[model samples]
Target: MQHDEFIIQVSNRAPLSSRDHAELATRATLETLAEPLAGGEPFNASAQLPRGIAEYLRHQYAESGERFSLDEFFGRISQREGVELPDAVHHARVVIEVLSEAISSGEINDICSQLPSGLEPLFEASSQGQIRVNT
Candidate 1:
């Protein structure tokens, strides 16, 4: 997907009319996701994304993943996104759902390899065809 399309998906999925909000959600989620990604997984995964949106995934991280729990991960995303934890969690799911569609399975799997099973709910729902109705 192109950058606009990717942002649109994030916007619509997040149900936010603000274009900047969409960009922020996308940016924050991706940037935070990069922290725990080690080796070349982040770069390889970025390769599959749109060039504009890809920058968020590239960051100088540790040789190994930055160890943290799923809650702490969302907390960082929450702070970076400037939203509440609940909103951050929701935005994360939206951004990741869009990301799954935007990239190849192998690339996503490689990204997933860096995450522990506990964080699976963030992205696996889309892959498993699990519909989440947050009402």
Candidate 2:
């Protein structure tokens, strides 16, 4: 998907009001995902993502090599967004679900393969359609 399509899909799946808001949320989520997959073959996993999403992941390629678990990932997002943990989790789920739609299934599968087992629930949740957004 293109940047505009990505933003629209994310906005539709999330509570955010505009494309700018979706862009911010999407970038934050992709950056957080990069933290775990950095400095390895997995680091290049984002290459198969949509152009816009890939850009977000690429921006974090040179990050300080921070690593985090799924829980910590949500915590960092919460802190950065200044929202409660639950809200952050919800936002991350929405972003991930939208990403699943925006990218090829093989890419999503490759990403999941690179992550720890603990993070499986996030992808499973998205696949189960647990967070559908009203059109």
Candidate 3:
């Protein structure tokens, strides 16, 4: 999907009001999701993401190259967003759902391939009937 369309979809799916809010949410979610990957994998996987969202993941990879577990991923997002864990998970699901529609199956598969087995469910949950990753 195009950048504008991606933002509109995110805004509609999320509780955000404007494109800027949608952009912020997208960036935050992408960064949180990418935080678990090592080396340049995050940037490579983010290549198929929306432009603004991809930049955020690339920036995180360049700046810190931090790695964490799936639990820590949601924890950090919850803390940063000042929401509870369930809320953070819901936000993640929404973003991943949008991403599943925006990017190609190959791209999604590539991203999931880099993630550990435990993390795959997080993305797959959003995909629902569309993408199913065997655990």
lDDT of each: 0.80, 0.68, 0.68
TM-score, candidate number 1: 0.87
Off by over 4 Å in 3: 62-67, 125-135
Q: What count of clashes does model 1 give?
A: 0
Q: Which ten residues in a row have the lowest lDDT in candidate 1?
A: 126-135
**lDDT: which candidate is best?**
1
Query: Which residue pairs of candidate 3 clash?
Result: none
- Backbone Cα, N, C clashes tallied per candidate: 0, 0, 0
Per-residue alpha-carbon lDDT of candidate 3 for residues 11-103, written as tens digits (9 for 90 to 100): 888767677767766766777767656657667766776676677677634425355667777777777666788767666667777887877
**What's the lDDT for candidate 3?**
0.68
- Candidate with the greatest TM-score versus the true structure: 1
TM-score, one value per model: 0.87, 0.76, 0.76
lDDT: worst 10-residue window of model 2 = 126-135
Error of 1 at 94 (Å): 0.1
Clashing pairs in 2: none
Per-residue lDDT of 47 in model 1: 87
